[model samples]
Target: MRQAPSERGIDPHLHRDITELIEGLEFEHQEQERATAEVSWYKEHTLFFSLV
Candidate 1:
């Protein structure tokens, strides 16, 4: 929290946008994580199999 834009000597005008930036970054990170997990699951499974 101490390293936030408002505390790091950033312009006061830009400080107000920090929350929005954090939210956007969080969303993007979650999307990327979800995609990675899906890929891992796919790699652990087989695309074809025999019933015999």
Candidate 2:
């Protein structure tokens, strides 16, 4: 009859603990992306190096 929030990309019960966890994960993911981008740029900027 009705689906839970988790099934729809949401979680109510987890709202208490999961909210904080997800927030941290979001931040971490963004940081990782930034780091990856920086590394990519360094590799590309190098004159004689290929890291990717």
Candidate 3:
């Protein structure tokens, strides 16, 4: 069965799902940035890259 669009031109459930998805993506982005920063710090101060 087909569904009708909400007043905002999208289904309300779809809007909700999209919002959650964006939030999840943002959270993951923040996590990756944090991890990268940590690794970058180690790379700058450690001998892990001296041999290369």
Q: Per-candidate TM vs. native?
A: 0.45, 0.45, 0.58
Q: What lDDT tens digits, residue by residue, belong to model 3 across residues 4-48?
A: 544349777988999999997797666666666876554333432
lDDT values for all models = 0.63, 0.64, 0.65
Best TM-score goes to which candidate? 3
At residue 41, candidate 2 shows an lDDT of 60
For model 1, how does the per-residue alpha-carbon lDDT over 1-52 read when each residue is reduced to its tens digit? 2587556687756766997789877976666667668766544333433253
Using TM-score as the yardstick, the better of models 1 and 3 is 3
Candidate 3 residue-pair clash tally: 0
lDDT of 2 at 6: 63
Question: Candidate 3 regions off by >4 Å?
Answer: 1-8, 39-52
Top-down lDDT ranking: 3, 2, 1
Worst 10 residues of 1 by lDDT: 43-52
Candidate 2 lDDT? 0.64
